[model samples]
Target: MARFTHSNKHTYTGTLLLLSCLALIGAALIADFMLASSSYSPAYLSIASKWAREKSGFIVVPNLNASKVGQKESMAVKDKAERIPERSLSATFADLPAPELEWEQMPSAPVPRLDGAAIQIKNLFYVFAGYGTLDYVHSHVDVYNFSDNKWVDRFDMPKEMAHSHLGVVSDGRYIYVVSGQYGPQCRGPTARTFVLDTKMRKWRSMPPLPAPRYSPATQLWRGRLHVMGGSKENRHTPGLEHWSIAVKDGKALEKEWRTEISIPRGGPHRACIVIKDRLFVIGGQEGDFMAKPGSPIFKCSRRHEVVYADVYMLDEEMKWKTLPPMPKPNSHIECAWVIVNNSIIITGGTTEKHPVTKRMILVGEVFQFHLDSLTWSVIGKLPYRVKTTLTGFWDGWLYFTSGQRDRGPDNPQPRKVIGEMWRTKLHL
Candidate 1:
């Protein structure tokens, strides 16, 4: 209320204006620092919203609880982003490729044939009678020495020996050749059995079976030679009979084959293996080649075949039990077991016919059956589809020789029998 002067009034107004400008500048700098520290903070968002509304002539309200929720959401997003790479890394490691298995070609067999028998005795591999070209049957044995990697010797089989479809097995020193097709081309089977002494290279007659079977499954188990499941004399008829004969020193201790528990499913071309007193028979067919009636030459009759994937196990109690079947139907894989890592591996056999073409499809996948889990998995593949492949496992390598290969679309005949041998390092 003092007397006013013009100069004093101007000076007072100037001082108030300068102080207001300094205060506004300080507030703007503080707001910039808060936004840089946490742009998603509710307070900063509220200020931005307020500025936007003022510029756009709209209403805005600050939500206090949104600040806490925004912080939690931001932390969750950051944590998820950090964990994504760890999961990806773990998946990458799990999907690493299986060890590469490369197959190497070995020396070919002395003679190319089909429906033959093979057995491994230490370093020597013996190839027995088989069907040659044009309905001819071979009655000879070819011996291959793995150490020398060559066909070491060839010897004539006994005159009474069956030429094809013989059930053959070895006991480290002696080879037991059982009943099979006596001659060739849909001919009848023989009940006579014989044993070959590998060391002496001599064949001796054994007791005969009650009846003849074509391509029977034979194995030596617990001092007894077990024979079971083949086509009967009718050829197309499935034989369920199981027989065994006691033997020692390559001679049958019994005068005749003794009857035993019959197999669950039976025909021929099944793979049989004995593991720790358990007998496992896997994959076979219901029908086989038949001889046409009144045909002097016993020409094969056109027939329908029912391939199966049934698996059975003979337990210690002498009882048959069912097991998990193969992933697909497989047959003509008489001796295809490679025991590795408590699992049995079977390769190269005939599977189901092609659905479209209704033609036989040979197997190429290497199948693994885990003994403990009783599960099946496809581990790898063969170089090509094949059947009747004689397989042997030695020194961590799998060897296969003598099989009928797949002749492509041009070949009218389904089988192109080969003598080529192959080996590959087994990696499971």
Candidate 2:
């Protein structure tokens, strides 16, 4: 408003430029205010409609009052609590059970002997008369004391009966030895019967068996020595007849041998055990069978002999009843059988039957038969192939003495003998 002198041209131009910049800034602020107010103002209707249509797909609809993350976390926690029940989880964990079987290996026996006469008198296991080697039979008696876990030398068996295949039974105080073979395969069997007074460590002669037999299944039942199936002439020809002799005054009485029912199929190498006053006879070798007339294999071969897997039960009424047979054929050729936990266990036997060969396959498969269910299951197996092995049960352990091992598959070789003794404890 004050009166001013005339300025330079440059000063005038600078003032004009500053005014122009101010005007542009004012216009920009007015445009921003108008656009911001367009949501409610009627003047910007067209522009607002176009912007809403274009930005509809890209619009972010946000919940201002409630946080999205917090809502999701709350829903997850509620669903988990509703789905999972505490009582159900607790019951599931509580119903779980523990395992059943456990086996423990124990100390070994002193010497290696197969087909030995083994009987338990008190806590001592008497092992007598067995095949020591392929060429020799043993007469020395070894007593294993379970209390001390050591072996003691007992009186050797009589010199005349250095034998194997002896049928042995115990009367707690005395052990009775029945028919046996003097030597190995094909050797003639002896009928000489003897009783060993364990307390006196002496052997005394008794009335012998009516005829010589080997591997007879012998059992002392009701004051009588019962003898059953065994080889009379050879391993192939098994004696089917059954005989029993009464015992009195710790000796075989003057009573002659009485006859009982004979075996249905003759199998000399049979395994017999007494359960619940009944006798169970298990697998053995039942000779051979002829080939069928119209079979392809029969056209080439006339006869093929198979091993036996038969099972029979003898009741107290002198009656014989057939039972379920073994799952596999057993050519015990030589084996050991025992009863544990109400189950009949058979070990160290072969199943193979060659139509033409002198060689026999050996196995260590341990098979167990459950009396209740009458089913067979494999419990465990021996480390090495075993045949003609001696077995004893004491405390809770099963002792396996020396037996024959298989030589490599070279048709036929002398079976290797094992000196190692193994024992396994059965955990209930």
Candidate 3:
């Protein structure tokens, strides 16, 4: 019985030795495959390293293509870092390196008004007639002194001068005030043209327009005062008439305005600018608020206003050519231009109405029109949305004051007309 038991034990020991040898041979095959194959996965390396550590008590380092793996990982990180999110219409301007762009509020004007015209001569900003509260029209001039940062002077305008919508321009010393609405709301325009001598602070009559116009785009170009586009007598119809007259020393050389080529798209509240003798008209609306036919012409309604972004330029060849339209349509932005870095910067006007609310949408963006490139870009924004904002540029600063401000950020409807002035440094 003892001899039979000893034989069975010997057979069992031999079987165990055979199984151990086969397991070692299988592990050797797996290790060889992991080291030899270039396409071996990370999982294979992990399993091989685990087996080697458990059996031999030594770590197995993977022979991965370190350079290629590093390069691929680095490229993935770079791509993620360089990705830029898409911007929206209301996005803030960020083309240039951002500077300190906070707006500083200045002293408010004496009286709040809208549709006013302002021009800077030296250090003085002359604010002309505008529409006041409750159908009242301001027929006076408020002069602001930059040195003192205060409203320094106030003077009465000519009784014959129109109260609002006057096309005003300055030639250092002389200010040409052209045709405009003579009275309050819905009043017919006047053909009487006047020039203000800043040195003398005196008013002189110039050759009147062939017919009166409302908010005509007026600018001085090569010794000639050019006037083009405005609303007609009905206050709703657009007038495409263009006229000019030779002028030296604020007085027209001719007795009558010579008719010239009409503007392509005629409307009111457009900015007229002359850069390098090139005439450009931009941003106006076709229809204006119309007066309801009644005993009093003060009652009005904005039933048919259509703002547009169309831009037109009159070249030296005496032909009008269409330029690229604005980033968005704008109106009630007459006389809003500040020349900086070979570009014209316009700010704050009425854009198209809100799609959902059907209310007027005021513009808060600072638009830059590059003369060299003829391109439009939203460079910055205002503190809030506004329309008819009086603009001035002085000593590396852009100033704006006196306009109708929007209700709130959530509400685009216009709320109140303000005379508060604000300015920001132009980091050119």
How many clashes does the backbone of model 3 have?
Answer: 0
Between prediction 2 and prediction 3, which has the larger TM-score?
Answer: 3
Query: How much lDDT does candidate 1 score?
Result: 0.76
lDDT of 2 by residue, 1-428 (tens): 33445776566678877988999989866764553343232312332232233312212222222222222333546556543232111111101122223334445556677666677776787887777664577777888776676676656788766388778878789888888877643355788888888888888888878888777888877778888887764444667988898986569786578887897766556677777888777877755322344554332222333456678888878788887666455655333766788888776665543322324556555667888877766566565566766666778877666667665432222276665666777653
Superposed model 2: Cα runs more than 4 Å off? 1-110, 287-306, 333-335, 354-358, 408-414
lDDT of 2: 0.63
**Tens-place lDDT digits, model 3, residues 196-239:** 99999999998889988999999999899989899998788999
RMSD of 2: 29.3
Choose 1 or 3, whichever is better by TM-score: 3
How do the residues 138-188 of candidate 1 rate in per-residue lDDT, one tens digit apiece? 989898887777889999999988888788887789899999988878898
lDDT (0 to 1) per candidate:
0.76, 0.63, 0.79
The regions of model 3 sitting more than 4 angstroms off are 1-100
Clash totals in order? 0, 0, 0
